[model samples]
Target: MTTTTEPTARPRTHKRVPAAPNRARKNPTRKRGPGSYAVIAAVTVFVLAFLSPFAIILVNSFKTGADYRANGSLSLPEQWNWSVIGDVWERVEFTQKLINSIQISLGVVLIAVVLALFNAYAIGIGRVRWRTAFLVFFLGVNVLPQEGLVYPIYYLFKEMGLYDGKLGYTILVGITYSAFGTYLLSSVFSSFPKELIEAASLDGAGRWTILWRIVLPMSWPTLSVMCVFFFVWSWNEFLYPLVLLISNDNQTVPLGLSVLQGQYSSDPTSMSAAALLGVIPMIVFFLIFQRSLTRGLTAGAVK
Candidate 1:
């Protein structure tokens, strides 16, 4: 009887135990913290801020002046019209301006690219004396704003009788643009494979022969990229061309656009459309040669 009572009392003293934690299930359905959402929101805001101005420009370009003034600059237009581009073109004499732009841009590209190639070869590969000094001088020139040079150049051009003509202006721009090309092309030339150059030298190749036969042929892509950049820069150049080109006949696209601003200052739509047209060639040029540009930029950064 005593044994049976002791066994029953032991059953009454039993306690409950907790189950083990799930170590095998690694972070199932992890909830994103507030930081991730904040990052996404910030990036979206940054993108929108940058794009808003261009979006407004494109939208406003399609609307009439009346609508734009009535609805404000950011409002959606009741009507969209493509004819504004044509009207602006006719008023601005777009054809002549386009021709002038092309001529000036081509001249700049040709002169700058060719001179840059020769000068960079001398400095970068040929190891010319005082090369670092020359590079520093060009760097100083490159950083000097066109505004600072305008007065000096204006006086110089007047003295030389080159102030208001297309050829003279083109020459001036090409020379200024060559500063950038020289630096960029020097980098490209400096990055050329030393082993190949040594091999060619061992093969009895003279400097001129190496430049023309090996360097020039191999660097066509970089040359093309530099040419395109030079062309675009010369095309969009406003101040130098504006100050130098007083004659209506010699004015380029940017000058024409400025003229339209005075003539059609009240008509914002027409002005924007014409401005858009002027930049279209640049956009197209970049799109077409983007691959080459990308390649050229990367190809000479390393041996």
Candidate 2:
């Protein structure tokens, strides 16, 4: 009894466990090699090269004709002439051109997106026969040069009485743009989750209902990106607008910018001003849809 009581009086000693070392703290700074620096330098140079034209346009826009001609487009303006923008604006009736551009771009985007959705739905989700052939046809349409079709399109539109007006041009551009949009969206839709489509079908959802409710909702990011691209493409269209639009009232911004140039000699400053102005709207549009574009681009990678 006395031995048992003495054994019970002894206190137990515990062994301590070592804590894990933080891998992050061991190597806080990452060492970049010469290749990294070279890549960075190369990217910087490319960016500067790409932006140089815009820089020249901006610098010359604020310069006088004499200053631009004498000191060159690369030189800084002798005086900051804010009036040049206003003068160029009035000369080109830029407000009307801007409105025309907005209308055409919006209209084309709507038509192209709708047509693309319909076409993509038929080819992609519907699992139609000859879908591969249809995709190939669309791809061929994209590759077909606008230069080759200009005459035919001009004649066709003229015959249809849709040649000169914004409505006609918008429709033409929308249809042209839809080919590429359809090709892009068809590829995206082809890879859509079959389970969702099947489930919807099992629940008595029709094609139209399934498309609007399930497909379209899930495809917003891609659709938004397509809309942005269509708007930009339509806005920057010079060839069709130049060919079809004869009246000053129906001209877009790119066509308006062309008015600033002469066959031989033109006001460099004024031309630069107009060019700078022309770029602003595109820049604004890009800025507005920048987030959507990013999402659409990364959606494939995320999946």
Candidate 3:
């Protein structure tokens, strides 16, 4: 007994545990190699190349026609002739054109978003019969060439006595644009959580109520993105406006800008000024809505 007790007390050794790794020391920051520097340089070159046109336009816009001709577009102006912008604006009736563009863009955004919401609601949330067929029809409409539809649209508008009018053009473009909006929003709404809708229904919410309260609020980000897209698309449209809006009073900014070009000869500085002016509104619009666009794009990636 005594020997056993003494043996138990003789030696009690503890096994050593290995220490945890120093994560920072083990995974040092990677040093940039030749490949990384090459990629960065390539990206910088591409960015500069893309921006060079805008830079040229801005620089030439400040020069007089004589100065522009003497030194070419790439050279700095001897003196900034700020009057070129004002002159171009007055020549093109730019204020009216700007107003027309705003009207058409806002109208298109409103009509397209509303119609798209209703159509997507019917197809996606309502689970309407032949939903696939409806989706396919929209896809067909989207892929259909605008050039081919021009003749038919022109004839139809003429018959309706709405040809060459801003109202008619807005309606046609809004409807045309809605096809895309519907297609895009339907896919989004189809994947929307049905639980929220079911719960709202259990609380006696009607379809209209559910759409207005639940669906619309949740889809605001996407709707905002669509609005911005529709605005830009409508603003930039050239072919339809050229064909339909014949009256100078009803002409959009693109049409106004086109008037600056002469078949035989045109003022380079004036054209540059007009180009700069034409681009500014879109740039402003983009800046204003950039946050919404970013939010909409990132929304799908999160909850």
Listed in order, each prediction's TM-score against the native is 0.80, 0.91, 0.90
lDDT of 2: 0.91
Model 1 C-alpha lDDT per residue in residues 38-76, reported as the tens digit of each score: 999999999999988778778888888789889988888
Maximum-TM-score candidate:
2
Clashing pairs in 1: none
Pairs that collide in candidate 2 are none
| C-alpha-based local distance difference test score of model 3 | 0.93
lDDT of each: 0.85, 0.91, 0.93
Deviation (Å) of 108 in candidate 2:
0.5
lDDT of each residue in 166-269, candidate 3, tens digit only: 99999999998999999999999999899999999999999999999999999998998999899999999999999999999999999999988999989989
> Residue 140 of model 1: what lDDT?
87
Per-residue lDDT for 9-88 in model 2, tens only?
Answer: 66777877787876675656778999999999999999999999999899989998778778887888889999999999
Model 2 ranges with Cα > 4 A deviation: 1-24, 301-303
Off by over 4 Å in 3: 1-27
